[model samples]
Target chain A: MKSAFRQSMAWLHTWVGLLLSWVLFFIFLTGTVGYFDDELDDWMTPQTPTFSATADDSLPVLEQFLATKGADLKNYSVSFPVDRTQPFLTISYRDADSKRQRIKLNPYTGEELTPRATAGGQTLYRMHYRLRYMPTKIAYYIVGVATMFMFLALITGVVIHKKIFKEFFTFRRGKKPTAWLDGHNLMSVMSLPFHFMITFTGFLLLLYTLMPLIMNAHYGEGKEGRDAFFKEYFSRTNVKASGIHEPSLELKTLLERADAEMAGKPLAWLSVANVGDKNSIFEAGSIHKNLSDSRDKWVFDANNGELIKVQIGHESSKSFYYVLRSLHEGLFASTPLRWLYFLTGLLGTGMIASGMVLWTVKRRTKAIKSGGGSFGYRFTEGLNLACLLGLPAGIAMYLIANRVLPLELSERTLWEVNSLFITFSAFILVAVAKAIAKKADSAWVSLTFLTGFLYVLVPIVNAITTEHNLLLSVLNQNWVFVGVDAVCITVAMACFVLGNYLNKIFNVKVNQQEHSAGPDFKRGHAS
Target chain B: MIILLSMLIMFHALLFLLLAMPKYNKQISVFPKRDKKLESNFRHVGYVLLVICIALLIVDNGVGVGIALVCGLLTFLGSLVSVMFTFNQTNTAASLIWLPKKIFGVISSSSAYFYLVGYGVLVTSFTLFF
Candidate 1:
């Protein structure tokens, strides 16, 4: 009975893991990359200047932008590039037509900069949650379901792999084909806290959508109710324009006081809303220093700089929620901590990728005994490689697209995104084709090599087209751009090493023959 | 710098803890046999080192961020150790295990070393956590 129970659990773990592994893989990989979205943004937009300018230095540029361009606008928000996430003087206003005009200016020079449009890191970051080519609501539901499964998988994994005590036993032999479990459990226990934390926090992030009925019941029904609930729960301020023209006090005075109020919070974004109106308000919000609170905000009356509202601290429940939200986003993470997040996230990705790979590994013997695998088997084989290697290859192509695509082209952003999907789809086809041809090992080896090649091209193409080439970036001390180049090269090395290992796995001759016996060897040498 | 320091300390802490386990001793330990007294000593030292790591981090960073960072670093280093074990990379483990083995052999034979670490952990934790 004990054995049966364990068997059932093992079976459940496998099937459940396999079911959503592809989607989860995509989510995990993309979300991992999202940690460095700001850095990627700097890399993608090579026009961004590197300087050590403070908020005080950028304040004049902000003042000038508002004095000239924002003079006639009734709703404008300006923020100095005080934070690493957004390193520019961002002035956004509505024109006479009420069409929003947002511009990035050099904080020191006060000159407007027009960066060529490409689907930057923000898109990739958004894609992790919102996903692409689908309605956001549906995507939320899908991701929420995936998160739930991920949570379940973690729990089930723990339950089944209760032999964590065995991890200490170096001499133990697997009485069954539980190499996957042994590996999975060891890796899981190593980072189980993180896996659980990230997943649970992620699930909580979509709590409103996941369990909308609770809010609808309390706050009243429909979208209006949801909006109302969010406004109160999140403590968002809504100020409508009164249309009465009031000469507003200079923002400098308010900001000085606001800075005093904040003390020494690292990430502060100040916005002036209902601009030029009687109800105009200046809001300065700082994400907490140690990440205890998400934000401590101060609101001031635009006319006289009198403090209107001070939003600080929440109830215990709300405070807990704030901490969880901060942990989920990791907004307060230093560069070192951020790298830890990325590496751990990659570990999570590896865990999922390995499980997905093992699903096929465990089945290969049976499939071969039965001649060829079923459609589902072949499809999964294809999708596994597609998710693991193909997606990254596509991402490499996306970066390459940014560098190589015509800068003046209309709909460049769309094309850049299209390039990613196009590359991804091509590899999907290659994988599926290779799987169908019963050369899955060759497919893995070749795709891994191709992924490495594309990654190598990422830095190369950047060097060819952009001023932020590796040499100049290093010389200029532009670490973000240099990091991008360095990471691509590192990724290329990783791919080459993995490809070499995989080529040896089946002793697949397509790559191995060329590697060991030169390119003269033919396809006939493959097993 | 705190991250690197924490990871390094934690690595030693984990290594000591692993060395205490007899099964791992059978496979990975250079001594090739477990000394029951030494195992007890190593285990105590391991737990104390971990306590010191967490306390040091909390003191340095703060209560909330420090704990959170510890959580992250714990997972990262734990995964790394897991990888080493998984690959059965005894060479790497042996290299890491060398200093700790030498130190533990000398230190574990004497209870004073354990007492000293325990006292340090207590003082640091008391000063900060209080």
Candidate 2:
């Protein structure tokens, strides 16, 4: 009975681990990429120029928009200039009807340009955390559940191994599935610290979902308790509007004044409330690209610039959570940390890949010894191959779409998203076919090679598409894009090498199984 | 705030490590009857310290935090390994010596449950305060 229960748990552990491993891989990959989301956005929109805004530039631009669209400016947020890509002094506020309006102006000229609204990298970053399919609440719940299971798998895996340290330094190269499995175990075991940290932090980051039952039980299950909780927690209070009229001051000047008040910290952003109203507030503070330190600016008063109250970045228990959250997100570090995260993320993905492959290998050997495979076994094998190879193929397809599609094309973002799903679906279908044909190993190699090919071409494609070729980019020190592209190419080359090893291992495993099997087993073997 | 939090995390880590020592290893009683909340505080606080240690490694080179976290991990491993060694120990004196460590090992592993609970409560407090 004990043995039966152990077997049942083992079965559960394997299936659950396999089923969710791919999603977790995607989560890890995208989350790692998002660590340098700001850098990516900057790289993507390299054309934007960075300049400090002065009152001379700010007032004229403000007046131009104000004369024609003062009412529109009433409920808009004015964001001060930070970087070159951000050429606009922006106001984003809700109008009388509570409709969101974002008005971007030349802080230098104050002329409103078209509202800049194509989520550069921010969309991807958010989507990584809150999956794209559903509302954030629902999606987070799903993620939380998945994360819990992943933690379980990690623990069970450690428990089952029994040879943790013995296998710590183990790496069986060029042995097809065994080699893959060994690689997986080594990566997972060696980076146990990282994996544990990531999983725990992931759960903590989404603490709201995991323990909402506590909130529901203690606080009321409705908005009243929730709002009260937040209000008290953050020491936030909403001020009632005082009915009066006053002209809004230049946002650039307000930002400078706020920065001056903060003493040495650069102004990251400025927001205006009650714009053109008597109780308008201008808030500005130090630029915090990362949530390492909690320093923010909240300046408010009558529109005539009477100081209401100023809140500098204050550290509280909540702020500490943010700092931890930032640490998990790798926001505090510069380029090196992002790369370290990316490499570790790949190791994580590789770990998952190996685990998935190991399941199939183990199943195939059992089936061969048993003289045939079950329907469930066949379906799982097919699904495994589909997911393992197909996802990368799909990502490649997205990159291809990004380049081939017209730059000014309508719904380009939608097209990019669609292309990913479409390519993924297509590869999955191919995997099914390969699995049915009993060509799983060949399919793996072919898909890997294809992915490699596509990856290596990205830099070449970029060079062809943009004015910045490799030489000029090198000379101009545009290493970010260049380095990423170069790394992709190297990764592609490594994948090809891996594919070759997989092919040899697949042959050896099949041959070895046939050798161990008697004539009767050979008779049952499919071509 | 982070500096203080870091200190608190390290303190817990050090306490757990001390508790898991082969000679000193014994189940800590938050109350006479095995309270999970108290137990998990030790384990989860260890986990948090480990995370902060990693974050510190990433942000800056604070060798002290690193050394403390490492020692905490070694202590955990040592206690867990000692439990196995006790069961296999042929000499009665050796087995007797490991009995306390085994009890402590049980105590430490069980600490995970309480730690998670404490973390949840703390997070709730953070969200409220922030």
Candidate 3:
């Protein structure tokens, strides 16, 4: 009975892992990259200078800049540069034509910095959950299902590996299936806590999409129901706008009062609503420093700077959700801890990639014996190649496109995203064509080499296009740009080494086949 | 500073666990016999040290950040050890059994009196300098 149960678990682990492994790989890789989303944003916008300015210091400069707009501003927001990730103050407001506009400014000088147009890391971060070419709600449901499958796979994997701890110390290299299995096992077991926590928290974050029945049951149907659910469930109090126009108080004064109320906790953002009205409201939100506590926002009368209400702490259920969301986002993480998070996320990506490869490797022998195997085997192998190698190449191409594409090009950000898909689709086509020709090994080697070469070219392109090359960045102690360059070079070297190794393996296989079946068979089989 | 110290403690504990494995008994010359009691004792001490390190981390950085940091550090250390052992066959479990013996040999060849007097001098100098 016990053996039967173990066998069932092993079966479950394999199928669940294989079914969503590709999407999970994309999710994991993008999410891993998303850990440095802000840093990537900084690197992409090279025109923005790095400077440290307190909220109090930047608020006045921001106000003066807004006053110069010469429009009856309605509904505007000023985001202070509270951390290194965001070094420039950002003002977002509706222009005279009622078109929304955003501009970054050097807080000290209040001089506008026109950074080059790019999709930035925000696109990559959103793609992890929202995905592309699909409605966001549909994408969230898909990603949520994949996350739940990941949790299932982790649990079943643990059940099947009876000697989990013992296997942690064992890694046999230079062996066919054993090597891959050992790698998958080692990565999974070594970072089991992180994998489990990330998966569980990721699922929880998308619970609204996964299980909308609760909201439906509580508030009935349609958009009004959803809005009502959020208003009540989140304990939000809405004040209606009064049409009486009045001049608002200085934002600096309101910020000071909010800061005093929150005991000097740094305010992350301020939202002003009912602008140009008598009942205008200003909400100042304090950044949450720990996952256990919820963020606090103080609402004040915009005209008088009088405190209206303070929203701090969450109820029981909301607190639980907040903590889970915070853990997954890592917003409170310090430098060392954040690096650790990134490393662990990389390991999770490796675990998923290795598992996908191991699936192909485990069946290769059978497939070869059966004269190129079944349709499923060939398709899986092709996809494995396309996803594992093609995605990185596509990402590298995307980064390169950001530098090479014309800044004044129409819909530049859209084209940048399009370039990624186009490059990725091209690689997928190559993989599929090579798989059909029975030259999968060649496809892997070429794609990996291209990926390595593209990554290597990114820094060179950056140097030609911008002044923040590796040397200059290092001299100025700009670690964000320096780190991006260093990581790119290191990844390039790794890819080159991998490509070389794959070439050697392919050569050996060819030689063996020739020796066994003579020249005639080799000629017929050669693509 | 505390994170670094915790990482160091975990690394040494993992090293101790690796050393205590029965598979390395043949490779290591200093500990020829399979001392089960010694291995058990080392395991206990390692766990205790890990617990203490975790408590210290939590006290220093609060619950949410502390747990995340510890997990991250642990994963980092595990990956480092796995990579090191995988690439260098000489550092694998089947080797490095004589590491302790070699270090002990260097210290044992000196006179006990001289070693004690050197230790005393080092301690006194460290105290005075600080």
Candidate 4:
């Protein structure tokens, strides 16, 4: 009975892991990249200077802008140029049409600065959960479903590892699927805690979108009901306008009063509602100070500067949500902690990538034994190779395009995004073409080389087109540019070593010789 | 600085745990021959080193951040040891112990005493730095 149960679990693990592993791979890889989103944002928007202007200096410009374009804005917020996250003072509000609007302002001169446009790191971060060219609601459901399967995979994976403790330090790099299995198992077991936490938090993040019926039943249906639910869900408050025109206390005064309450945390952003009304309320928030708690908020009366409410901690259920959110986003991490998050994220991503390859490689053996694989096997391997290498290559192209593309080009941001998807799709197409021609082995080796080449090309193009070259960045102690260049070169070297390894194992001539000798299991990797 | 030290200790601890397994005992062959007493000693020592690593991190950074760092570094160091075994990089693993022994001038030439001295130095460094 025990053996049967284990067998069933193994079956379940394989299928569940195989079915969503592609989408999961994409989700994991993009989510891992999201860790350095801020640093990448700095690198991409090079023309934007690092602003160190004080809040007092930037407030008058903010007030002047608010008086003009913000006349009709009932609820607007100002983000101070306090730190690396958003290094320039900015004001954001929803327009009459209810679409969100934001503008950047020069901290010292008060002039509007329009930096060179690009689809920055936020887009890539968003692409992980929101996906691309699709409605967010739909993407949420897709990512939500994937997260559920991932959680299941982790559970079944743990159950199936009979030698869990004994094999904790085991990874034998021998033969095709054996090595791939070791890579997969080592990654999975080593980071099991992080994998579980991230997957659970990721699913929790999408819970409202996934099961809207529970909220809908209580609050009614459609957009308004969802908004109402969310307001209550997040413990948000609203103030009624007195309709009497009275200019509230200066923004500067309100912030100073709230300063002591913030407990040394940097100012994140603040909002004022009812603007000039007598009963206007203001809200100030601080950036995250720890892992479990996100930014804290202090709500006050804009007219009197009296603290109305302070949300330092929450009740149990809400606190649980906050902790999950904090762990998922990891905004509270220090430099070393952030690297830990990143490396663990890469481990999780590698787990999924290696699992997919193992599944395909195992099947390839059987398909060969049966006298050549069906088109499905060929296509799957090709797609696996495409994703494992092509996505990184596409990302390298995205970085290069940011530097090399014409700055004056119209819709430049959109083109930058397009370049990534186009390169990725072209690689897929080429892999598919070779799969159809029965030369998938050669395609894998060549594409691996090409991906490495593209990554190596990134820093070269950056040096040619930008003044923030690696050498200058290092000399100036501009760690952002230096980090980006160093990581690119590191990734390129890894790819080259991997390409060389695959080249040795999946050489076309060797594969062709094996083809003449009947179906074999010697080809390395997905080939 | 503290994190790197903690990670180094954690990595060595995991390596000891790996070497304790009889399969790994033969596979790595870091010692002249695997003694039952030595493997048992390694097993206990590995757990002890892990505890010391956690304590060092806690002393360096307060509990809240310390625990978080320990959790992350565990996955990282575990993977490092696993990869070492995967690629049969046992010589590289042995050299880590060998260098520490030579540097500290082992009163005893055993890997166990060498690690103890290494830990002593690490704790001293942590104390001085903090």
TM-score of each: 0.89, 0.69, 0.90, 0.90
TM-score of 3: 0.90
Model 4 - which docking category? medium
| Local accuracy by lDDT, each model | 0.78, 0.61, 0.80, 0.82
For model 1, residues A52-140, the per-residue Cα lDDT tens digits are 45678888887777778657666777656666776777777788898998888898889987777878888887888898899999999
Q: Of the candidates numbered 1 and 2, which has the greater DockQ value? A: 1
Residue A415 alpha-carbon offset, candidate 4, angstroms: 2.3
* Chain B vs. true chain B: TM-score per candidate: 0.72, 0.36, 0.62, 0.82
Report the lDDT tens digits of candidate 4 across residue range A8-56.
Answer: 9989999899888878988888888898888888889887776766566
Task: Rank candidates by TM-score, best first.
Answer: 3, 4, 1, 2
Q: Which wins on lDDT, candidate 2 or candidate 3?
A: 3
Best by lDDT: 4
RMSD of each: 5.0, 12.1, 4.9, 4.6
Docking class of 1: acceptable
Give one digit per residue, the lDDT tens place, for model 2 in B51-129: 6544643343334333323433333333333333334323322322233344454433554345435545754464467
Model 2 TM-score, 2 decimals: 0.69
Q: Per-residue error at A96 for model 2, in Å?
A: 8.8
Task: Tell me which residue pairs clash in candidate 1.
Answer: none
- Per-model interface RMSD values are 3.6, 10.4, 1.3, 1.6
Judge candidate 4 against the unseen true structure and give its global Cα lDDT, from 0 to 1.
Answer: 0.82
Candidate 3, clashing residue pairs? B28-B97
lDDT of 3 by residue, A1-527 (tens): 99999999999998999999989999999898888888888888887676677788787787798688644776777777887556778888877787999888888888888877888888988899998999999999899989989999999999999888756566778898999999899899989999999999999888877888978988987788999998988866466778787887766777777888878688777877766679888988766577865567888998888899887778788888888888898888877787888899999999999999999899988887887778778878888889988888878888888998988999999888888889889988988878766778888898999989988998999899999999999999999889889989999999999999999998998889768778777778893
